[model samples]
Target: MTTKMVFAQPQPVLDARESDEWTSGICDCCDNKPQCCFAFWCCPCFACVKTRKYGQCLCLPLLDIFGPAHPATLAMRVSMRHRYGIKGTICKDCAIATFCTACAWCQMAREMDSRAIPIALVGTRPTQ
Candidate 1:
């Protein structure tokens, strides 16, 4: 007798167009006054908090001063965009990271908090 093994395929959790939703814009920080104040007054701490929430080291954002590239900020933005399948270009991400780092970070934090369900935890599953 011969035996065979089979593996189940995963399903798509969201609809095709679901990923097209726009994220919170960078200047929308005032939508949440407390969070806005935190980000504005303590940008480094806020950035560190946001980085840690993404499962990275809390102090990782401090690396931004090492260069104009703002590697840590870029990584967070890229990861967030990929996780949510958000429609955006790398040029935009780089520009935001390079010119408006604080606003970018604040927007990311708001996006993550505003989502009813965290994108990262929305695994592949059947859509009702």
Candidate 2:
């Protein structure tokens, strides 16, 4: 007797367009005014909030201040790009994280917000 094994094919989670490029530009803060304003006024707080939203520890972004390389920002940006299948190079991510830290955080925030999926819970009603 011979036995055969079959594997299921993987399906994409996000739409095709989402995988092509960033939803907004690094400097397109106008795409999300409130996020931009918050990022501008309190960058650390904004970074912390965005970091938490990305499923990282709330204090993750605070580590960026200790090092000149802004490691936290670079990591977040690279992770986001990879998760979303956005086309970008690590060198570009490093440059953005190093030079435009606030804009980078804001761009990530906007991308996450745009791709957010709402969850709906269903409960059975009690009989009268």
C-alpha RMSD (angstroms) for model 1? 6.4
RMSD of 2: 7.4
Q: Residue 14, candidate 2: how far off, in angstroms?
A: 7.1
Report the error of model 2 at residue 19, Å. 2.8
Highest TM-score: give the candidate number: 2
Error of 1 at 87 (Å): 0.7
Lowest summed lDDT across 10 adjacent residues in model 1 is found at 118-127
lDDT of each: 0.81, 0.87
What is the per-residue lDDT of model 2 for residues 29-125, given as tens digits with 9 covering 90 to 100? 9987988999999999999998998899999999998978899999999999888888999999999999999999999999988888765555645
lDDT score for residue 82 of model 2: 85
Off by over 4 Å in 1: 1-17, 116-128
